[model samples]
Target: MADLSIDFVGIKSPNPFWLASAPPTDKAYNVERAFEAGWGGVVWKTLGEDPAAVNVSSRYSAIYDSYGEVSGFNNIELITDRSLEVNLREIEAVKKSWPDRALVVSLMVPCEEQAWKTIVKEVEKTGADGLELNFGCPHGMPERGMGAAVGQVPEYVEQVARWCKMYCKMPVIVKLTPNITDIRFPARAAKRGGADAVSLINTINSITGIDLDNMVARPIVDGKSTHGGYCGPAVKPIALSMTSEIARDPETMGLPISGIGGISNWRDAAEFISLGAGCVQVCTAAMIYGFRIVEEMKTGLANWMDSKGFETIEDFRGLAVPNTTDWKYLNMNYKVVASIDEDKCIGCGRCYIGCEDTSHQAIDLKPQADGTNKFEIIEEECVGCNLCQITCPVDDCITMERRDVGQPYMNWTQDPRNPHREVTEESTHEA
Candidate 1:
């Protein structure tokens, strides 16, 4: 088996799958069970001053199909409901008992240097390995100017990060919020403040649906509802894009990333690694399936790594970065037209119907003398937009064939239909 172990900012874990700071990691009991179930690390749920922090009952809501399959989760929950002293005591006990596991404590508090200083000392005394500044919780905390509030302001992010770095003995990982316009801003800001690493994609603000019966919004609490954070498979694409943006940015490229949001399997984990995430975080999937899912994540990832001959995470990390670039850098001359393999086509006519009605009449469906139908692409009329490829249900039935750039010529540069082109008299004179 290939080595699945990873070292993120001096904290070593036997594998890259670390449970995100959520309900599962709220206490020692849950964390110990996760460790036994093969999770490399757990970020203890966000801890803060207990005197002021109070949580509501019925802190979570879910979207279900008619059959009641959870498609999304909505949480009105704030940080950990447990008292600070109790959480610290549990952390101390868990760390002492499971010294080999990666134990990171998540913290959220008033954006004050004194408050940070006091808490860091208390958390450090618990003998935890590291700390994650919970700047991503979109609900409850934001109302009090805590979670997403500090995260939205890049200056506050840097300021808080600096305080943690200065006062805390443990490595500080800034867990970022996804609500900001550009993820790189806070990422860079955290780096400026001496953050050791950054974890991302806390949650996106969302209203799942409406309660038609009550004539009110969903996840209704006391006949009122505020937008809660959204997380699940739905947020994976957004999370992946944000993670890639920060990883590829030169200003913050070297900073380690803990990829979070919508990761459910080994393939998802591999995608984050290829895009430069040092390790991956999980919450929604684990919550839905339970801790035992880590067993399959670890096994599946290890098997895939061995098959691909990747001896370490660094072997394939950021391998896809070089291929990602701006639109201008994309080769305009490159071309690919959808080609359907006759043998693989099931005569579903899905491609034909889709193309005939909505796209260019590029596909010709012909019935042979033997009463068999086949679909072929009109090479000349095929614009290579790939609509047929997308509509095809069978994988590899339709493939895009790249056309060689015979000459450095582009129709877009000279097309009169292009809105960007100016019909100037000087160009007319040349014409």
Candidate 2:
């Protein structure tokens, strides 16, 4: 089996899987259990100043499908309820007990330098491996001008990150908020502040649904519901896009990134690494399944790595970044035509319906002389958009074939077509 060990900012872990700063890492007992379950590290739940925060009893709600599958997760939950003293003690205890496992404490307080300075002094004394600044919580803390509120403002993100770097001796990771207009802004700011790494994304602001009969938002607290953070599988694409944006952007290029949000399995972890995340964090996935899910994550990643002949995680990390680029840079001359495997076609007509109505009229569907349905591609008319390939239910049934760009006959690039272009003899002599 391939080695699954990873080292992030000098903090070594048996694997790349770390629990996010959520319920799973709220207390010492919980974090210990996570480590025992095969997790390589745990970012203890967000802890703040002396005054403890109180959370609603029913702070969590679920968006379930007809099959009772959890399509999404909503939480009005705030940071840790425990005091700084309790959290530090637990961090110290856990670190001493499991010295090999990574123990990073997450913190969020007032953005002022004094507030950050005081907390960092105390947290560093605990001897935790690292620290993660909690700038992504989008719910209860935003009202205090913390969490997403601070994260949304690029200036505040930079200032707070700088404070952490100045005050803390350990590695500082800035956890980014997904509620912002553009994620690259905060990521770039964090890197400017000397952050060891950045982790994303915190939950997004959302109201899952209202109880129509009672006319109430979800997780009704005191007969009223405010917007909570949304997570789960639904947010994976959003998280991936933001991570890829930060990874590929010129401003924050080469910065270490920790991927979070909707990471449920080894495949998802591999995708995150391929997209430039050095490590992967999990919360909702472990909450949905048990902590034992890490066992599968470890084994699966190891097995896949072995099969691919990758000796270590770094071999495959950021393997896909070079292929990602802006749309304007794309070569318009490149083209692809759709091809269908006759034996593999399920005849679901989904591609036909999608292409015939919504997309470019690329597919030709008609009845054969033998009273059988036949689907063919109109090569001349096909724009090669690949909508049919996406809509096809069967795998490999519809494939896109790349068309070679032929020599241009229009001569648009020639001097004749340009205003600055002098009408040369060849242009003037042409009919």
Candidate 3:
């Protein structure tokens, strides 16, 4: 069996799967159950100084797919509503009991230096492994000059992180928000302030959908609604892109990452690690399915590592970072054409309709001799966009086949078609 344990930024855990600071880690009861279920670590839910931050009745909304499965989730809930002393006591007790498991406290107080400094000192006595600065909450917290409000300003992010680093003895991981336009800015700011690592991303600002009958948005409270923080499977692409952006940037290079957002299984965790994350955090998946999901995540990841000849998590961590690059560096001469298997085609006409109406007119419907309709791709017109394959009902019926064009590598910077090619060449020659 491969070793699943990881030592992330000096905090060692049995595995890289930690529960994100959400409802799942809101209390000692939930965190204890998650530990028993085999999760490696837990970042206690965001704790703040506000004890009067009341929660609404209908604080959640969800987006479901055609089959009624939750594709995305939204929440207007605030941070931990419990008192500061009670949360601190629970953290101490939990850390005492589970000494081996990583217990990092997540904190968000008023943006003042004194407020942050005081909380950091209080949490340091809890015997916790580390602290995650929660500057990513997008919903209720932002209105009070916290959460995304602090994250949106790079200067504030740097200043707050510096305060935490100065006052706290343990590792400081800054949890960044995805609500900003450029994630790299905040990441670089965190690095400048001496953070041990950075975790991302916080939920996106979203209104799941409106209620057609009530003429109001979902999760309505007293016939009114406000935009909530959106998360879950739908946000995975955005999260992954941001993670990759930080991982590959020259300025933020070598900075540790604690990947969060939309991670549900072992494969998702592995992908994040490959993209340079030292560990991964999960919340929505555990909310939908109980903590038992960690069992599968552990077993699946171990089996995959064994098959790939990886003896430890570090063996494959950040393996894909080098391959991630800017768009201009992509190979423009690589060609691929769509091919359809006639025997497996169900004649759904979905591919034909999609290609003809929305995509390139590559696939056409033909009437066979036995009065059956068959869809065939036009070799000349097919751009290998994979639209037909995505729309096709039958799996493996449509596949894109790569064709060797035998052309040398060419990019926009050096391509003859570019009007600035002459200037680019002249600059290069001068250098």
Total clashes for model 2: 0
Tens-place lDDT digits, model 2, residues 248-307:
998998899999988988999999999999899999989989899999999999999999
lDDT (Cα, tens digit) per residue for candidate 1, span 268-361: 9999999999999999999999999998998899899999999999999999877775443344566788888988999989999989999999
Per-residue lDDT of candidate 3, residues 354-397 (tens digit):
99999889988999999889888899999999998898888899
Better of 2 and 3 by lDDT: 3
Q: Residue 305 in candidate 3 has what lDDT?
A: 96
- Candidate lDDT scores, in order, read 0.88, 0.88, 0.91
RMSD, candidate 2, Å: 5.2
Question: Could you tell me every candidate's TM-score relative to the true structure?
Answer: 0.91, 0.91, 0.96
lDDT of 2: 0.88
**Highest-scoring model, TM-score:** 3
Residue 230 in candidate 1 has what lDDT? 88
Pick by lDDT: 1 or 3, better one: 3
Top-lDDT candidate index: 3
Question: Could you tell me the lDDT of residue 276 within candidate 2?
Answer: 93
Q: Give the clashing pairs for model 2.
A: none
